[model samples]
Target: MLLRLLLLICAPLCEPTELFLKPSPSQTIEGNSMTLTCEIQPRLQTSKAQLQFCFFKDNGALKSGWNSSPELRILAMWTKDSGSYWCEAKTAKATTTIRSRRLWIQVQRVPVSDVSLETQPPGGHVTEGKKLVLVCSVAKGTGNITFLWYKGAMGLKLGTKTKHALTAEFEILTARENDTEQYYCAANNGFGLSLSGLVSITVRIPVSRPVLTLRTTGAQAVVGDMVELHCEAQRGSPPVLYQFYLKDVTLGSSWASSTGGASFNLSLTAERSGNYSCEASNGLEAQHSEAVPLIITVPTENRRDLLTSGVIEGLLGILGPTTFVLLFCYCLKRKIGRRSARESLRSTSSPLPQDSTYLNSPTPVPLQPVYGNVNTLSGDDIYSLVYSTQLEQESPAEPPRTLSKDKVSLPIYSKLKKITVIDMDYDDAV
Candidate 1:
């Protein structure tokens, strides 16, 4: 009996006996209302129990007020009503209980057939022979959706599909310039139809290789000669402007006729002799011509004649006296050289006779009359002595020495003898 009493008391006090409501894991949105219903389960007798319900968010915040009603009403549901929600209940026995099951609310927007279009390799223009991809997609919708692609003003459909989103690709493996067009996309469901914004794509064709032909009025251009250069592109489009360049600098420009050719006239000076090239450009593209060198040769003789008759003549007039002075100096140098040569010969081979007036008389006179003994004699003394000897021989006062022919040679031989005599008296005095 005591054991049964202890069991009854212990059971009621053991981990508060609870009863609560369990909501379904998912709830859907339809029309303007959303209903959230919960199922109640009790661990004890709920017949006598009064239950109160409370709703809580997944973040542990209370979302609705406490009540006994199992269903919560959301009027005019929107995307903000979508979240995790749960219920709590308290019994009259003071036994409180919490439900473990979670609810996920989802608000479904009305389906629409409106679609938007996008393209890859995005640009307003593309090159010829290039591949293009166009994608069309509905922003919000349910059920099957259809898509269509059109090109140009005629609204010709290039492709079609039956899906919520569709993608189409167009390839012109070898596209020409004429392949330019406007494009758009369309989407349709059983409910409604929608069209995408229009787009324009232009396919560009590359410029052709330019043919450069040099045109000149004359075969040869002389320096300081005026000439014209004509560059033509026979296959190109026009209002084409031709730019004439020498060594890559724009010298001048000319406008071509509708035939796509142009000419520029330039005076051929010395500075214009180099690689000459031209470029032709429309608004689309520009092409350069192959370099053609223009060589201008001027005759040296003609230039020299012009120089001499012009500025050079005036220059020569001012410098003529200086030139003459230089020539006169050169002639004087030649005359001085000849005079020096003659002086050298006279000094070496025939010496000038000494002036006798500057000579001292011989010491103590000669002791004996030594013929050819005269050592001190001026030029005048020698001349006078020689004249006196010649006069004495011519005079009739003295007879000439007579001897045989063999003897006659003796006096001449004696006169020719060079005698070196020493005087003892002059030596002793020294």
Candidate 2:
């Protein structure tokens, strides 16, 4: 009984020594809470021991100093928080310090969002034979992410990448005409996939010197004949505008939307017979073609034959109508003459009218004098003679009134006198 009492007294003096870190729900996702505890073995019964706890990650202290609480709570966990973690326990006076074994915590991340696709130069436009790059990125995603590049259609995969980064890129060593198409990308983190909007890529090529060709309907180009001017560029973009030049003056322009060239019809004339050239452009620098000389030949014999044939056809068209009209007029005249002869014979045999209405004679009427305004001067002359009716009835008893200076200076002439003198100059006087 004395030995048992001694053992109990010794147990009261003993202190706890083991230390460990315990985490609830070790694996967690982002935006979730987790609790971590610093545990001690052999709970203190009678000893006056005060303990302090601290948390660490990858050997880095989580707090500035030791805390009185033995539990550490993480309000929101993230992928970056995943690492080796350990806890330390000590007394207020630091009489003893104990460290627990390191522990690893894995924090998952949310699904991908805000997926976008961009280009290196930022316009998605690249010149032929140059390098082009396509970049795909996400605003929020973690863990191993898989990026896919597509061209034209979704099923046609251009490339793929799997890495632990937020962004990825695909390169085209040499851009070509076939590379001008729509492109897009997709990002996945083994949880869900997100697709980006379609991006259009344009590959431009500088216009090449065009080749101008002339095609004639006949063996030789002749005056007043239609000739075709064909201009084509061996390598260039579609919707190319081709302009035809005569010597150095612009004739006309033609647009071509396909690989083949454009054509402009020209009517051969004496002035149009000269050096011809063409140019091609598609919103870039224009390219000119070599000048081609042309000479028009005139055929006199062919022209005379054409004129004779045309005159003969015109006569034939009018001959039928003229003959039909002449025949109808002659037949109608003959029928009217026969009817008139019969009517005259019947009238001679019939009795005459006894009424004297046909013997009446008409009376003759006197002519009246005419009064009019006469203009003697020619060639847009404003001066003319104005005859007033008031002067037409003048009393013979009254002498002829003389004209005043103002009356003569004016352009009005109301009285006309008959002169008996034989001087011809007086008749022409104004």
Candidate 1 local lDDT, 1-430, one digit each (tens): 9999867644543545433333332344433565566555434334423656767767774557767776776665655566777776655455645564666666554555556666654774665566666777777554456778888878988877785333334443554566577778877655566888888776654334455555555678787677777777755545677888889898888876577477777877756788888887755678888998888776798678767787878878888888999999999997797666545434543222221111123332332322232242232121110100101122245344322233211112112212223221112110
Name the TM-score of candidate 2: 0.51
Each prediction's Cα RMSD? Answer: 17.9, 22.8
Task: Give the clashing residue pairs of candidate 1, or none.
Answer: 356-378
lDDT values for all models: 0.58, 0.74
Clashing pairs in 2: none
Q: Candidate 2, which ten residues in sequence have the lowest lDDT sum?
A: 420-429
Task: Write model 2 residue lDDT over 1-430, tens digit each, in one string.
Answer: 9999867755533554677888877678776789998877765452434667788999689963587787888887777888998988766664657789998898978788888999876799887888999999999886778999999865589999998778999999899999999999999987877999999999988679999999988988998899999999988877799999998899999898888889999999756788999999988669999999998886788667767887888987989799899999999997897666555444443222121111112432222222222323223222223222112222357554432323322233433232111110111011
Clash counts for all predictions: 1, 0
Please, what is the TM-score per model? 0.41, 0.51
Candidate 1 residue spans exceeding 4 A from truth: 1-123, 129-131, 135-144, 161-175, 218-243, 253-263, 280-287, 296-430
